[model samples]
Target: MSAAQDPGTPPRPHAMLIAQITDPHIGLQPGPATGPLDPTGSLRRALAHVRALQPAVDVLLLTGDLADSGRPQDYAEIATLLADTLPTPADGGPRVLAVPGNHDRRAPARQALAAAMPVAPDAPGDCVCLHVEHGGLHLIGLDTVVPGAAHGALAAEQLAWLQRHLTACAGAPVLIFMHHPPLISGMAAMDACGLLQGRAELGRIVAAHGGVQAIAAGHLHRAIVGQLGGAPVVVAPSSSHQLTLDLRPDAPLALRFEPPMIGLYRWTAADGIACHFSYVEAFGPSHPI
Candidate 1:
């Protein structure tokens, strides 16, 4: 694909709401593992905020950091909670989407969400991709989980799959989802977990393809959106608890009950994409109708 468009032609952007929910640190207890975090409880509250949105959302994307530990049971817990709580077409709401993060154990996560897992059981690999078309828009979810590492990387296999999908889409506008950020944000300490090992190769793949509208990710426990090698990247905040960024090793365990955040990304065939964020408060500001 060429960088500059020919005269009389302009880059086209797809319009759709891709709701990104990240880092709902499940199974977090109030003790050492969680460091005074209430992951399960917090996620419940956050869901309430999401349920009350005025305009409603189209697609639901969970950005990862799924379980506190990479245990099979933790994954089961996530599957159960998500099925009951999150919005979906069956429940008169948006269809749910997800990708695995560092905290997510690929094996168990794959077993439970068999639909999303790449190769089926007895297959050599595990990964899943979804194609959703809503109002002249398409969204795709990609898996980027690597076993036994604080850092994140997208494998050659996954990239190959992404390439094929983008090629198939042709001119259709698309949004890519993953567990790790393809790029980094500020805050030195948290940046360690932000690296994608084969990023250069991934860039070339995206460079070769022109349909990707934006890339959204989860990790870092903070809200950030920026450009990566010419692509838009948005990082969603965790619903469970946030990792306070303090480069100092000696700083006290800095965890707090900052209300978890949820997003409302609005897209219109005429207007392109826009986003808004709000927290899980006890009771939202009152209004007169």
Candidate 2:
């Protein structure tokens, strides 16, 4: 009999649940005139949605752009917001992890988020990199912030670090999270600021390791997917606003009021990994069909 029909067969292991909310761009004084009135409010709603999920999320990943201008006060405010909205790990809340974006100041971001989302002890002084193990899965967060530039890149040292980690986790599944996507998005302006350096080397590393299940990122303010070294790259939508879908060669950057969304990633040894984009807003109660 098939496993489904055989009552004696053990059930499959529970899947690991991960929720990603990115590009909130919080602390915009006079928030964007188009999207949600307050960026923090949007982030709060997204976090609440994650908290309310039936099977609580195992990890909450703040991909990047947590602050609009990467100010110290902004990060302070973000820390407060996180403390107020999410319960402590001791209280059964998911582990929080973050990486800096182009809009973030590495020093301030590291200082503020450290208390809540600590990085690996071996992480370099120049950037924030995280490594965590949960339910036999390896989660790695790579910092792609380039300080004064809008584009992103990984330093050689950081790349070497990543290679060492991937090698150590040779046969285990790994999920990578970062700020800027390595692949080019058709959006002209956005593509110009995409991961300009280390793209090829990163791809080679992932291909050689062959254990990376998926790579998740933010920075485009929209959901995008592409392939890098045979693994799917899932870019999460912004929690505050989305960029207009303009693929023209010279299309200017623009914002849209599309519903804010988050990325839900589920992984299991039996089914591999799957990503789903979920809207953060509450759309009335469901009625039986």
TM-score per prediction, in order, is: 0.81, 0.92
Residue 37, candidate 1: alpha-carbon lDDT: 73
Model 1 clash tally? 3
lDDT of 2 by residue, 1-289 (tens): 0001112212237787889999988887664466445788888889889889868787789999999998899888888878888887668777788888888888888898885456676666667887777666778889998879999998898898888878877667889999999899999999899999999999999999898999999999898999899899999999988899999999989888788899999988778999999989889988999
Candidate 1 lDDT by residue in tens digits, 1-289: 1111122212335344556678886776577654657777777666656666655655677777778676788778767776677655655565566677887787777787554333312222655444444445556666666777878877777677667666766767667777778775655556666655767777787767765667777787766787665667777778877667665645443555555787557666566566666676656467899
- Evaluate model 1: give its lDDT: 0.65
Give each model's whole-structure lDDT.
0.65, 0.84
| TM-score, predicted candidate 2 vs. hidden true structure | 0.92
Minimum summed lDDT over a 10-residue window in model 1 is located at 1-10
What's model 2's lDDT at 183? Answer: 92
Position 128, candidate 2: lDDT: 83
